[model samples]
Target: MPSFHNGAVEIAYLDEGEGDPIVLVHGFASSKNVNWVYPAWVSELKKDGRRVIALDNRGHGDSVKLYDASQYDIAMMANDVLALLDHLDLERADVMGYSLGSRMTAVLALSQPRRLRSAILGGIGIGMIEGGGPGENVAAALEAPSLEAVTDPVGRTFRAFADQTRSDRRALAACLRGSRRLMTADEAAGIAVPVLIAVGTADEIAGSAQALGKIIPGSEVLDIPHRDHMRAVGDKVYKAGVLDFLSRQD
Candidate 1:
């Protein structure tokens, strides 16, 4: 429940275990518990004698929401995390982010490359940029008064989809204005550190998972056979792949 004063925004995070510090970032709207606490990453990393820092981004979870859309951009979001690292006086740490969190992770790599020992970005792609709000059909449904707000079955379903695909309202709103400037395949190529991007075979988000891995040298592409974006975290192959990537650093 503790918080850190990271610039104008205060970030709430879980600081547990001990050893090489690693930060876990969840998708927008989803709390640390939803995206990661259920996953084996925390226990798996901690079991290997490492510290885990799971963050609740502004406007979500236990953290205070930034009413201003501008504050929700990836650059600002990354800074909130950097400030947390500064407050803790740590120089560098490995970062792992899913969906919206992955966009922030990319920004961290670009803006604060020195602070990141490595990174893991999941559930995203350059293909998303081509008129990537919801599809034309869903936009109409989203416009309906009943669908505008979350808390309903359709809204709940969409919320999960959003989390898995970086569709948080404020975050996406910011993205429309280039607030969450996602990197192109070429830009991502500049990042020299070990990076991993994985997707589930059944995920409608992208037709293929292998396409991304081929773009980043030394990067591995993994597909969870029966899982979608929402269920990928629970797959043994997903966990094993990510854990193996991180464990290699030691």
Candidate 2:
């Protein structure tokens, strides 16, 4: 694991394989290893001959933890990705993100389109515009004394995940509270780069993949049949679609 300073925050990341670069960003309460590596994403992508880079967002995994809710704004988190690209001297590369990371990917695609060859948004759909995910209830769940104290279904799921990961619950609470901004339809429509939006057919967390696709001009959508938000991460269909999407770019 290597790290670099994005201002005061230390971001831990893994850079593996060789060839054209593709950065991976994990979801909320999840780290690079859990979200990408354990799911065989790095291995599969490497097998496809890509330079894979994944990072621990600030306040998650091995990255510097911050307790201030104001520090976890979506743009701030997105900037970390930009900083990572700058650190690696990559002027532009394919970028992929899951769940919360999807939001960051969209921000980069919209605000800094020139920095991305393409964008892959997994575990996210119209929620990018309609706005839904871990809300204050999830934040409250993170602040709860224990998972048993979290009764909200969604909250409990995230709390249990945080416990399983042995993450900084307090820091996650702030991140959940701060990184709740949603993009407007105009913003989503503004994205000009090649975009691939993949969501499970059974995913309740991500809205409609087709709906989002319709919003982003020329964007492609891939549906992971019968998979939900969590299970969709490593689905074969999702992997194949991504590889195909990447291949088309070359």
Candidate 3:
């Protein structure tokens, strides 16, 4: 895993193939391999002659772990993406993210749209963008003494997944604490780049893709029928939608 320094923190990333660049950001507790490679996103994009660049956000995967809660701010993590682009000498590139990654993408779109040609926000919904999420619960769950100590269902599920992945639980708790920031309606309306908001029909965490689309002017929604949050990442509908969207950008 290739890595770079953003100040003192090291961010792990993978760059592959060639052509236009697409920087991929994975969801919380997921690494580049699990979110991008296992889903075959790299292969699919490569087939389309795209250069796939994906990074494990700080505190996840092979990136430097931070125990400080403030180190996990969404904006801080988003800047890591920008730093990677700088390291690679990319002036700008299409950016794609899922779940927590989607929120970070929105931060970039709001604070650093100059660094993006387009934005793809997956497994995210209007609710998360507006002001609601399981951040507090999830954070507490990550730090709980045991799985039995995690009472929230959402928190419990995430805790189990983190355990399964053998992730740094303390670091994840800090990430959740620092990354609960929300994007206001004004911020969403102000995004100037082409945007795609995608989610599965059965994804409870993602409030409504259609609702989110209505907020971003000219944005499009890709609905994967019958797929849930965990099942939507690698769905054929999602891959096709992304490919079609990228194709039209040329």
Candidate 4:
């Protein structure tokens, strides 16, 4: 149970492996274990001699949850990551994020691109380019009882997610507020670090991962065919693509 008091929250992170640091940021209603832990990706990277650090963002996993919606903003989340880096005394590291985590990494690139060795944005879409997302509506959906009704259930994806967050609705709702922070194309283009925008061809959530990648300097988009957002992260092709992206320096 490793933790860092990131000024605003105690970010619980899994620090494993050995070599250049690579931070893993998980998406909404997901923990480090759910997103990256079970995938065997961490061990694969460690075997490759790369350091892996997967964090539990505030309001998710073992970290503290703030009742305030403002705390769940992307800026705060990004700051918490920066604080974790500061706590570890690591000046620079590679970053990879998915869904809500991807948005957080986007804000980090915009605010402090120099601190990143490289970046991987997964399951990103054009719908979130405006730096804001649906608010109370998403929050309410998070709070609603699944046994009663679902305004627009996305089939098993919705049910699976509900089960995943069944124990902690508030944290999930807080993460839902984070959807409000989106980055425009021009904003993404400003990032000079090596980047990879990756998504599955069947990922309905990532409406435009390719479009998101094209704008960044020296960034590449890798499409994993026949996979959806939930399944993309575990594919060998996806892992290889991400590894190639991060390993290429200068």
lDDT of candidate 3 over 175-200, digit per residue (tens): 88888888888889999888999999
Show the lowest summed lDDT stretch of 10 residues, model 4: 126-135
- Model 1 lDDT per residue over 5-121, tens place: 776667789888999999988864567877878777788879878899999888767777554656766677777778878888989999988767877887787667789988887
CA RMSD, predictions in order: 4.2, 0.7, 1.2, 2.2
User: Which portions of model 2 miss their true places by more than 4 Å?
Assistant: none
Q: Rank the candidates by lDDT, best first.
A: 2, 3, 4, 1
Per-model TM-score, in order, reads 0.81, 0.99, 0.97, 0.91
Clashing pairs in 2: none
- lDDT, candidate 2, 59-132, per-residue tens: 99999999999999999999999999999999999999999999999999999989999999999999989988
Candidate 4 residues 1-113, lDDT tens each?
Answer: 99988774778999998899988898777888888889887888888789999998888888887777778878888888888788888899988998788888878877888
User: What local lDDT does model 3 show for residue 111?
Assistant: 81
TM-score of 1: 0.81
